[model samples]
Every structure is written in structure tokens, then in C-alpha cells.
Target: MADGTRIVDLEAVPEDGSYRLTAEDPFGNETELILVRCDGEPGVRAWSNTCPHESQSLDVGDGAAIRDGAIVCPRHGSHFDACSGECDDGPAAGTTLPGVDLAVADGAVHLADDRYAFLHEGGIDDDEPGSTSHLSL
Candidate 1:
């Protein structure tokens, strides 16, 4: 995906919070990728915004909720650690979000944009606004 696509300006993303960005996946599916800023880490973190349980975008526009430093999936309330993508609660208890490789450069979060942005065609309605998305581990 062009080496490293700039996702967002670092200052625009709140420390200890998250932001959702859109991209075209390697498979050509319009996808949503999430950018996370954690105080415990030196740089930004990222993941495919899809929750495994129902293949729903973990973020439903308002952004995924950060609870105790973890990402709480909006679909079924599953909480996944933003740092490690580990899930410890909800229907996706043993699964983790698929991680995306990221880097910090020139005051922005740059990602391998389409690296992890993939999902099966089934149930995905490309015609719906922002209905495009991801698939996490």
C-alpha cells in the first residue's frame, strides 16, 4: 500500500484514545482501520477495525470505546487490548484483533494501510455508507 500511508496527524489523535481511518484493502474492499494512541507506548498502534464475533466494524462511527486501556468492540462489547490485540471478555474472549504494522514519521501515524485490511465478501454491503471494513484474528 505505497510503503507507508499516512493515517492521521499524531496531534489530532488524543493521547490515550483512538481514531478510525478508512482505506482500500489489498483485496480492494474499502476498509476501516483504527489508530490508537496509548500513553503506555512510545508511538501509535493500529488494527483492523472488525470484531471477529459478528464480523462487525469494532468501531461504529463514534469510534471504539477505550475501557481501562483496551478497545471495547461496539458490536458485542468485547474488550481487546489496544497494545496486544488480546481479548479478555465478551463473545470473542479468546480472539484478538488483527494487528497492522505502523510507524511514526513527520508527526503522523503511517501504516502499511492494506496490510491487514481484509474480509470475506459475504454479508458486506459495499453500497452502504461506511459499511466497508476488516477481519481480525
Candidate 2:
């Protein structure tokens, strides 16, 4: 087990929101991940930013909605356990968010997932399609 890439200090994680970051997989695919405060030894939990129901990003630049120790999906109001990534409500019930391995040590969170390499501190900004909502007058 490698030490992994250090992403952020545990103390810097928001107590009520999420810390978003981007990572690249071995296949050169970029994935957005969100880190949320959790209860237990690690003190942090990470999950892919996509919602299972529609694959929409859980965070839309503000941060994923978090409540009662769960990550609330912004698209359809699904609630996923922060630590377990298990959705128990909304359209995504019974589904789990893809998890990214992490290591918490010396007060910092490290990206320990062997399948991915840390890319940046936010979502990918490129030609990928996004929201298609019509502009309001």
C-alpha cells in the first residue's frame, strides 16, 4: 500500500458541505470525487460525484447537499450515506456511489486508490456535455 497523493488537510474539510476534487483513472478518464466529513477514525469519506439515477453531478459548483450524515443528490433528492455511499431514499435507493480509496493520516487526507491519480481540486472543465436548460430571458 503506497502512501498515496495528499489532497487536503482533514481540518480543511467543511463540516457541513463537501470538498470536491478531480482524479484520472488508468484509462485516462477524469472522475470527480467529493469528500465529506464523517464519523469514525478516518474523519473523512469520499465518493464519486455522479448520481446513480441520472449520472448528474451531485455537486454543481456549490457543493453536494449534505444532511443527517447523508449526501443528498441535487438532481432527484436521493440521500446516500456519507460513509457507506448507500442510497436509501429517492430514485437512487438501493444504489451505492462509486467509492475512491483514501488514507487519513497526520491530519491530512490522501488519495490512496491505486486505480486513479489525483488530477486537480475540482470538476473537469472541457467539451463534455452538461446542463441543457434553456436560457431564461
Candidate 3:
């Protein structure tokens, strides 16, 4: 967590499939990131936790829909690749979620890029509905 990048304890996330991460930094705003780990893959990935369609928090309800190896948005049933952030289905079909760059070291996940080191990327309201949050993409 050098440079004050928020760090998440990797061991705290489930290795099964997908999970939500509300990444926060004391000196920065909170960003909702989704933690993903697919079968046969050895590491964890963090994604912006917003459903690009409505800019709704992807983890707002019942967690991410993990089916057929993609993370489904709970709000509008949008699908995104667990590892690639590719929009596999739904409204934003051909688009990819803006990936939150991450690094793993000493059993933790840290921000890989300082540009998005803060949670206020693209001026998107991470918790609002009908927001143009995909500007980060």
C-alpha cells in the first residue's frame, strides 16, 4: 500500500468466483471494486463495481451474478467477464468495465495505477442510479 494505495487482504476474499470490494482510502474517496477469481486461475482481479447501464453499484444486491464465467450486474442483468472486464452481454454489450488496476504482494491487493488511486474516477457517482459513470471507461 505504498503511496497510500488502498490495500485489500487477498486472503479475505473467496477464491471461488466473484465478490464485491468497497475500496476506501483515508486520504481518498471510496471506490466500489468487484473482486474476481475464476476457476483454474491463480490470482484475484478487481473491477469497478458499477453496472455501466445505469451506473448502479454492481454489488448493491445479492452480490454479482456468477454464471458461465462472467459477472452479472444485479440491477439490469448485464454480464461482464470475470477476468477481462469484457461486456459479455446485456445493454453495454461490446464494452468493458473500466478495470481497477491492482497488484498482489505479501498476500494483499493494492492499486496499480495512481490515476485511479482515488475513488472519484470520471466524476461518476458510484452509488447513484442513471448516472453516466461509465466515463471512466
Best by lDDT: 2
> Which has the higher TM-score value, candidate number 2 or candidate number 3?
2
User: What TM-score does prediction 2 earn?
Assistant: 0.88
Worst 10 residues of 2 by lDDT: 126-135
lDDT of 2 by residue, 1-137 (tens): 33999998888789888888889999999888989988865889889999989998988666788899999988789999988999988999999999888998888899999999998786676223332233457
User: Which parts of model 1 are misplaced by more than 4 Å?
Assistant: 1-3, 113-137
Considering TM-score, where higher is better, how would the candidates rank from best to worst? 2, 1, 3
Candidate 3 lDDT over 51-116, as tens digits, reads 777887766533566777788777678888877888867887888888766777777766776545
lDDT of each model, Cα atoms only?
0.69, 0.85, 0.64
What TM-score do all the candidates reach, one by one? 0.74, 0.88, 0.66
Candidate 2 Cα RMSD after full superposition onto the native fold (Å): 4.5
> Candidate 1 residues 27-91, lDDT tens each?
67666677776655546677777887888886665567888888887778898888888998899
